[model samples]
Target: MRSTTTSASPLPPRQVGEIVYRPRVPHIMFSGYHHQPDATLETSRDLWWHTGDLGYTDEDGYFYFVDRKKDALRRRGENVSSQEVEAVLLTHPAVSAAAAIGVASDLGEQEVMAVVQVADNTELDLKDLFTHCDRSMPHFMVPRYYRLVDAMPATPTGKIRKAALRETGLTDDDWDAEAAGLTPTRHH
Candidate 1:
C-alpha cells in the first residue's frame, strides 16, 4: 500500500520593522552614499541579506564599511582589498592613477593585479614598485601582476571602469614593459 503525506503550510512573512527604522539599527555603514533609502532599509533589516562587506561601527553610532562588498580578492584564504592596493600604487610618484582587480592563479587562488596609468612622460619601475609594496602592504595585498596603460578607462563621473578591464582578461601581451621600466620588452 502507498501512503501520501501533505507538506506543512508555509509561515506568513513577519514585519519586524518599518523602513524608517533603518537609521536606528546598530551596524556598519559602507563608504558609498546611501541615496536609496528604501533599498538600504530593506538590506539592513532582511535576515537573509548578507552585507558581504567588512565594516565596523563607531562609538557614537556611525558605521563604516571599509572595503568593497564585491570584487574582494581571495588569496590563500585571505580577503585582499583591491582599493587598498590601488591606493598604495597611487602613492608612487610615477603613477598618475591605478585600478586593481583580481586574476585567477594557477593554484586556484585569486591574485591581485593592477592596471596603472603613469604620470605625464614618466615611467614606473615594476620591480621597485613591487619592493615598495612588500615593505608597506601585507604579502596578500601585493599585486601579483602589473599592466601599465596610457590611461585607466573611466566613466563620465571619473569612476574606473573595472568591468571593462576584467573582460579583457590578463593576457601576456597586455603588459607594457616599456611603461613599467621592465627592459622595454613586449609581453608577446
Candidate 2:
C-alpha cells in the first residue's frame, strides 16, 4: 500500500512532516509489534503510523521521495540529502540519472559517494562533473567518490533502489576525488 499522510487541517492535503503518517483504521493499522511491547509503531502524540521513509512536498502538494531515514548521510555534522545531490547532478547535460549514497569514512561519519548514469552517447569526465558539482552545490555536499554507469537499478514502480547501491559499497572502478587530491573550493 502507498503510504500517505493524514491532513492536519480541513485545508487541502499538503506535506505535514518528513515521516509518512496514516490514521489508525481497523484493517489498515497493524496490531502492534509482535512480542515487542517497547517497540510500539505509533508516534508519541498523534498516534500516526511511522513509515520510516523520508520525503518532501512540492508546491503543488505532491510528495517527492528523498531517501529512507536510514539512508540519510551525516557528513561534517550536516545531514546531506541524497535526492538533493542527485537533483543537482541531473542538471548537468551529460548526466541522465544519479544516486547518492553514504559510505563509511575514516573521519567517523559517512562520506558521499555518487553513482551517475551519463546521457546516451556521452562520455562522462570526472573532472568536468566535479567542476559542475563544485559550482552548483556546497563544498561539503560534494561527493568524495563517483562511479559512472550506463544505467541505475530501479524498482518495478520506477523508484531508484538505493539500498542495492549501498549494498555494493565502494568498488575498484569508482573514482576517488579526495584521494586524487581534488578538493572542491566553495564557489559561493
Candidate 3:
C-alpha cells in the first residue's frame, strides 16, 4: 500500500513523494468511488491508486508517511514541513495546540500559516510567538500568517482537523506580522 515512485528505480531513503499502490493479488483492487466516477478516475491512474498522503520508502521498503499532499507548503522556493512548524509552536506556553497549513499565494505555490488554540483566559502573545519561532526555525519555515482560536476543530479521534482550518485560511482576522512591519529577522 506504500510506494515512493511509480517507476522501479532505486531511490535514496526518505525521498518524500505521493504514496501510491496497486493490488498485488489478482483483481483485489477496490472497485471505484461510490457514485463518484470522477474521483475514481482521478485516483486510479497509471495502474496505481494514488494515496493523497505524502511519504517515503526506506531501503528495506518500509514506508514512512510525512505530510498530506495538500498540507505540504513551498514558500519562496523552500519546502516547509507543517509538522516541524507545529512542533515549535507547541513549545510555547500559550499554545495549547496548533495546526500549520498552506495558504494560497500569488507569489509562490503556497505560504506558511499557523492556526493555534489557546487555553481559556490565557493570552496568546504574537510578539513572543514570533520570537520563539524565529529562534527555533529558519525564516522560510516560520509562519507568515497566524490565527488564534478558542479551540481547534478536531477529528473524532482528537486529531486536529486541518482540512477544516484550511476552509478559513489567510483570513482578515489573522494577525499578519509582515503587514505590521514586524516580520522577525531570522538569526538561526
Candidate 4:
C-alpha cells in the first residue's frame, strides 16, 4: 500500500494529493458556488479548498509540479501528460515553445493538440514536427492537431496560460493530421 504520510517539506511537506488552502487563522472558508450547493460535491469529503493542482514528492523531499489535474489527457486507454508532450515538442529545432491540450476526438476519449511558437526566422513544418514527435514519443501521445503561432500567451512570470489556449479551441489555420489523411501507426 502507498504510504499515507508525505515526504518532509519545508513549507507543508511534499504531497501527492490535492493542494488545499486552509488557514490556521480565523477566516471564512468558502465552501461552494454562490448559489449552487451541488457544485461543491467533490469537496464534501474533506471540505478543504481544492486548488486543482497535481504534484508529487521525490524521495529526498522535493515537490515537483506535474500538471493541473484537469490537464491530464485520457487517450487510447492511457493517461498522457500534457507537460511531457510539450517537453518533447520543445526539443524540435524550429519550436521555441509548445503547449499540448486534449481535444475531442472521434477515435478515442481525446486527441493531443499542440500549439507551438517557432523560433525567430524559422518556418514550422507540421509534417516534420509530427515526424519528430512520432520518433520521440509514443504513437498515442503524438499530437493530432498542430497550431503554429507567433507567441504563446503567458503570465508576467513567464508561465504559459494553457487554459486560454484551450478556450480558443481549433481554428481554420490549424492543421489536422487525421483530416489531412496522414496515418501515424505504431510498429510493434
Candidate 5:
C-alpha cells in the first residue's frame, strides 16, 4: 500500500461533528450523532463531522436543514424553493437553462421571478409556457415575472450568477411585454 502524507506542514486543529448552538460558549458545539452524549473536544468516537449548516432533528430523528439563514425568501407566509422552480422551468422544451430568483412585491411578500435562456433559433410562445406552468406547478410556484435571454450569466464554475440577477429588478425593459400579453393579477 502507498503511504499518504501531506508535503506541507500540518494545519491547525479543527473541530468536526454535528454542530449545535450553545449560548454559554458563544461558540458552536460539535459532536457525533452516534458517538458522544457530551460535546467535548477530547472525545474521538464520532462517526460524522459537524457541518456549520443550521439544521434540526424531529422527535422521530429525521433531520432537516432550515435553509441558509441569510438568503431565505418569505412569500405570503410560505417559503419558496428557488431551486425547485428552476428545475420546473428546465423541463420546458424551449428553455436551455433557467434561473429563478425572488423579488419583493408590493403585497409585503416576495414573488418568484425567472430568467430563461432559450434554445438556439427557437422562439417560445410565452402564453403556452405560462399555461404549462399553471397546469404543472402550484400557483404560488409559478414565476410572476419572466425574462428571456440568449444565455444565463454564470460564474467560472458554471453556477448561475444569482447575485447579479437579484441586483437587476424585473422591469418592463427586461421583458418582452408584447409577447407576454397576459396581465398579472394585482394581489392585495
Candidate 6:
C-alpha cells in the first residue's frame, strides 16, 4: 500500500458506536495513511471509511457536525458534544473561556466536565452558571463537573488544550454537581 501525504487519526472503536462520518456505500475517502497500515485498516472496513466525527442529520437531511468522536462525551447513554457544552458555557457573562471534556463515570461511560476561565473583574458562581446552562441546553448536556481555572492550558495559537485538561484526573479543585445536589430541573 502506497503512503499518501497524510490521513488523520481514527477514533477508538469503542467510541465509534454513536457518531462518525462513515461512507455508507463505497467511496474514496482517502488513499491510505503514511506508513500506518493498522490505522488505515482500522478506519476502512468492508469498503467503508469511518471519518471519526460525531454528528447527526436533521429531519431536513442537513448533516450537523458536532465534535470529533474521540472528543465526544457519552453521558446518560447520549452522545454529548463538548463543543456544544462549551458554547453554552461561553454565553455566561462570568465565563471568559471554557473547555468541555469527558471524565470517567462509574457507569463505565464518560461524563461531561467543564473547565472554565472567569472573565476579568467577574466571579463565576457555580449555581448561576448551572442555572444558565440548564436553561440554555438539555439537562444531560449540562456539565456534571465544573473546574474554575485562572487560565486554561493553551497552545501558542491560543487553542485550549483539552488533552491537558483531561490528564488531570479527579482533582480536588473539580466540583461534582451530583454530590453537591445541583440538579438541572425544569423551570416554569
RMSD of each: 12.2, 6.4, 3.2, 6.4, 13.5, 7.0
Best by lDDT: 3
- Pairs that collide in candidate 5 are 17-49, 17-50, 18-50
Alpha carbon lDDT of each predicted model: 0.63, 0.77, 0.81, 0.76, 0.61, 0.77
Report the lDDT of model 2 for residue 21: 62
**Residue lDDT tens for model 4, 1-188:** 01113212224344344444454665566646777777676543343455566666676766676667788787888767899899999999999999999887788598899999999999878988988888888888889999988899999999898889889887888899878777666542
Q: What are the clashing pairs of model 2?
A: none
Best by TM-score: 3
lDDT of 5: 0.61
What TM-score would every model get versus the actual structure?
Answer: 0.64, 0.72, 0.80, 0.69, 0.61, 0.75
Sorted on TM-score, best first, the list reads 3, 6, 2, 4, 1, 5
Tens-digit lDDT string for candidate 3 (61-162)? 898767777778888887678988999999998898999998888796887888889866789888788888888998888887899888789888999888
Q: What local lDDT score does residue 134 receive in model 5, on the 0 to 100 scale?
A: 64
The digit string of per-residue lDDT tens for model 5 on 40-157 reads 4423223223233434455555555543323345567766567667778889999999987888787897877778999888888777667666666666777777888887789999
Worst 10 residues of 4 by lDDT: 1-10
How does model 3 fare in lDDT?
Answer: 0.81
lDDT tens per residue, model 6, 1-188: 11111333433323223333454555445678999999998877555456676555555555567787677888878878899899999999999999999998998888888899999999888978888988988888888889999999999999888889999966887888889888877532
105: Cα error in model 1, Å = 1.3
For model 1, state the Cα shift of residue 116 in Å: 0.5
Residue-level lDDT for 161 in candidate 2: 85
C-alpha lDDT of candidate 2 relative to the true structure: 0.77
Model 1, 1-188: lDDT tens digits are 00001112221232111111223454654623368877655444423333445444445544544465455677777767777888889888889989888877777877778888889989688887776666668766777678889878899999898888888877875553334653312111
- Candidate 3 segments exceeding 4 Å error: 1-12, 27-29, 58-62, 155-159, 184-188
Deviation of model 6 at 177, angstroms? 2.0
Off by over 4 Å in 1: 1-53, 58-62, 174-188
